[model samples]
Target: MKPEVSIVIPSYKNSPLDLENLHKNIANLDYPQVKVKVVNIKVSEGKKRIGYAEAANKGILRNKSDLILLINADTKLDKDLLKILVGYTRKNPEVGIVGPKVYSMSDPLEVSPVDLPVLSFNKFFGKMKKVDPLWLENKRKPFSVAWISGSCMLFRRRVWKKLSGFEKNYFMYWEDADFCMRTRNLGYKVFLVPNAKIWHRSGASIGKDNPERIYYVKRNSLYFLEKYTLPPGVILNGIKTTFLIFVKTLRYFLGEKEVSKAYIRAVFDYLRRKKG
Candidate 1:
């Protein structure tokens, strides 16, 4: 029997053409037991903009299915993608959340950094290595990961309720990592289903180099670090992370003064929230 799946897409100020493309792609999927819900957030006078987490929760509340898939408005799916994800979850009961291999729409083979490593302040402060192309091409089996991008993820409806959906305080970023960490604390595993793939127009909803994006990312990183780190490590990591942020601010200021200012403001805002 085919499992019922609800796809929740959170969209903000998307163009009519983009919505048509997204709907058309979903319509072509081979899966018969699927429902697509778009939680649209429009910006206008006397209306406040809703963030990704809240928008997603709104869509989730509208559907009652066995499995839920969270996807962004800027994504395009493959015909068998939903079938593959649902089939994997049905077989692996221990896996609570599954994310697909997302590729750049402009360059199909270039995978998005959705399959991220466990969060570590040391790594954040140190030099990072690029993901090897050989490993990406060779890894055909589903494997456990620290977390998967919320851009395109599948999980059981029961699990979503258990976690109480994405953390609303996150507003926009780091919510996926927060969700996965909480899911792991409950003894469930998060996996990357390499075979189920999709194409994403990276940062289409928000511009890639937008200062607002930079602010949210930096602020949210601090939030996650504080929430998860142990006491002594928290103090140590906090200092290290702050220093790293300062370094980044200096570097960004050289090229983009507005983005640098946003980064600095993010640190101050995060600190103020912690004290209050």
Candidate 2:
């Protein structure tokens, strides 16, 4: 018998059309609907919007399936995506987390980052590249990755419990990386199953250019970099933070004040060790 599966989706003010479309997609999926449980934690437009980390944790904890899938509401999982991801995990007992090869919804040719080396603050600014020859060749099989994007990840219940779910401190950005690192440290494999794919509207949940989004990303990155790297990482993070502050300062004078302040506040808030 196929193992029970639960999809935990964290959504914030997504359009009804999108929600209808998501359910429509889910309807088309190859997995048996009877064996699959879908949990949608829709967030209201409140004065304080809950973070994805917090929302996702709630959803994961709400399920009791053998396999828990964390997927974004702004994504279209291929018909076979869930089936493939579950198949990969079931065949490889050592695997704790697995995600599909994600394609940008706007540009199908573009592949999202997953198979890169473990994240370090210094390499965080590397340019995004398109699918290369190596990427295509590897798509035929599942491959281990440093981290899988939180946009869509499948996790075993035991592993989720062991890691205590996403670090609520992250609140949103980079929590996926932190989760994957902890998963790897516990001697479990985190895989990117290229055979399984999804089209994602990245940053749709949080405004792509929102000041709040920038703040969380910059601030949360500091926590991740600080915890994962040694002394050198701290030094690099400081340098990068300084550079960002300077850049944002210039932007402040150039009429990009709100966004600029977001970046500035991110540095200060990280220094103060503030979190959700």
Candidate 3:
């Protein structure tokens, strides 16, 4: 029998067109025994929402399944993904979390590369490359990662309860990595299920280089490092990353694009304590 799978998508109020697109993609999935839970969080009122953590928490609370799959609103759901994920869990009961192979929509075949420097360079260059064929070829074997994309996050309900869900303090960034670390600390493995795959529209929920993204990413990096890693290493990494971003921004400026400018503006906004 198939394990009950609940797909939870947390969405903020978006243009009707975008929502239509998202609905169409998820509906395209031909998976059976799936329950879809969409949690729409409105940003009005005095209530302060704690970003993805709150939205995901709400969605999880409303779901009724032993296997909970947290999907981003901007992802194209792959029907076979559910079965693949459940199969992995069934085979490896010690595994607490699993994420499907995520491809950027612009370059669908480009499986995320193993080289951090190359991946980071691509982000700086703003060029999406096709996934390395070797990476795709290795999907048959189950492997582990320090973290996985939250775009297609899957895990057992019991494990999620044990970890107490995402940390609300991290409004938008590093929360997934933090969760992976916690799971590992508790003596569980986080695996990347390559057979299960999805395409992600990068930065769909938040526009690219949006100041809000910068603020949360910056603040959350600090929070994550402080809370989970050695202070010296975290501080050093933070400084190094900031310096590299600065250099990359300058390089982009000479190449002519407002994206670089936007990125610098965001950094300034974060430093100046700009909200949202």
**What are the C-alpha RMSDs, in order, of all predicted structures?**
3.3, 3.2, 5.8
Better of 1 and 3 by TM-score: 1
CA-lDDT, candidates in order: 0.77, 0.79, 0.67
Model 1, span 52-127: residue lDDT tens: 8877777789888878888887888988898999899999999999988888787778776543433232333322
lDDT of 3 by residue, 54-127 (tens): 67777788877888888777777677777788888989989999888777677777763421111111212222
lDDT of 3 at 55: 71
CA deviation > 4 Å runs, candidate 2: 43-49, 113-138
Top candidate by lDDT: 2
Q: Give the TM-score of candidate 2.
A: 0.89
lDDT of 3 at 33: 60
* TM-score per candidate, chains pooled: 0.87, 0.89, 0.76
Candidate 1 residue-wise lDDT at 133: 47
Residue pairs in clash, model 2: none
Candidate 1: stretches off by over 4 Å: 33-46, 114-133, 245-255, 274-276
lDDT of 1 at 181: 78
